[model samples]
Target: MRERQPCVYILASGRHGTLYIGVTSDLLARLVQHREGLLKGFTSRYGVIRLAWFEMADTMAAAITREKQLKKWNRDWKCRLIERCNPEWDDLAISLGLPPLRTIEGTR
Candidate 1:
């Protein structure tokens, strides 16, 4: 079995688009759920399926704290944060071996 690694992540609808911040113990599984539209809520409703940014935490508590902090951040600050690591705002899930997400017309 794989050891659990907590992570704080940000999802986006597109570059400079709607953003959602969350924390998960299994990043890959969570990303897959979001990508497949299985987890119903803000992300599914807004089409925020692209993995824009992420950070690993020492523990689930730490990841949750960081997620709260990011959630409170303003849009500009959040965008800058994502840009620092992913300038193009590309779907980071692809880097994790998941297939590239299909682009929906007008979502960008």
Candidate 2:
């Protein structure tokens, strides 16, 4: 069986665009859903599907806590956090072992 890792992740519409912070035990599945527009809500509505940043945690509780903390952070702080790990604001899914999402009609 595959082990689930707790993680806090951020999704973006584009560089410096709308952002969404979330915690998940299955990062790959979650990202897949977001990328496919399966889990409808803020992410789908805003086209915030890029995996901009993420941090793994020892436990789900810790991941959730970190996600909440990041959510409270101001936009500039969040941007800095993402840039610190992803200077180019690239989709990190490929680095994390997921398939790259192809851009369609200039949309991600």
Candidate 3:
């Protein structure tokens, strides 16, 4: 099997509401889970499952460290980072080459 890549992702409630930062080996799958409200957690509770930003890492450990660091950054810093690459707040799941899901859009 191919090696698993770790990714750090941020989900937002909307344009500017709750923000959730997470690290996972399967970023697409995890994002789907969050969007479907299949997981009972921060994203579901706060409706923060809109993909906002992401960064790939060589390993899960590195991704975890980066996720922690980003979580600690102030709001402005996080916004700037997201806007640097995803100014329109578009979903990163599709951009990452995954099949589009309806959870991201009603008619996908």
Residue 75, candidate 1: Cα error in Å is 0.9
Q: Report the candidate with higher TM-score, 2 versus 3.
A: 2
- After TM-score superposition, what is the CA distance of residue 66 in candidate 2 from its true location, in Å? 0.6
- Total clashing pairs in model 2: 0
Model 1 global lDDT (CA atoms, 0 to 1): 0.90
User: In model 3, which runs have C-alpha deviations exceeding 4 angstroms?
Assistant: 1-3, 97-108
Model 2, range 27-84, lDDT digits (tens) per residue?
9899989988999899999989999998999999999899889989999999999999
Alpha-carbon RMSD, each predicted model: 2.0, 2.0, 3.3
Residue 20, model 2: Cα distance from true site in angstroms: 0.2
Please list the C-alpha lDDT of all candidates, in the order they appear. Answer: 0.90, 0.90, 0.80
Error in Å for residue 104 of model 1 = 2.7
Question: On residues 1-108, what C-alpha lDDT tens digit does candidate 3 reach at each position?
Answer: 123579888987666557899999988788779978999977888888778888889888999999999989999998888889888777677766655544546522
Off by over 4 Å in 1: 1-3, 106-108
Q: Across residues 1-108, which tens digit of lDDT does each residue of candidate 1 receive?
A: 134699999999899988999999999999999988999999999989999999999989999999999888899999999999999999998888899886567453
Whole-model lDDT, model 2: 0.90
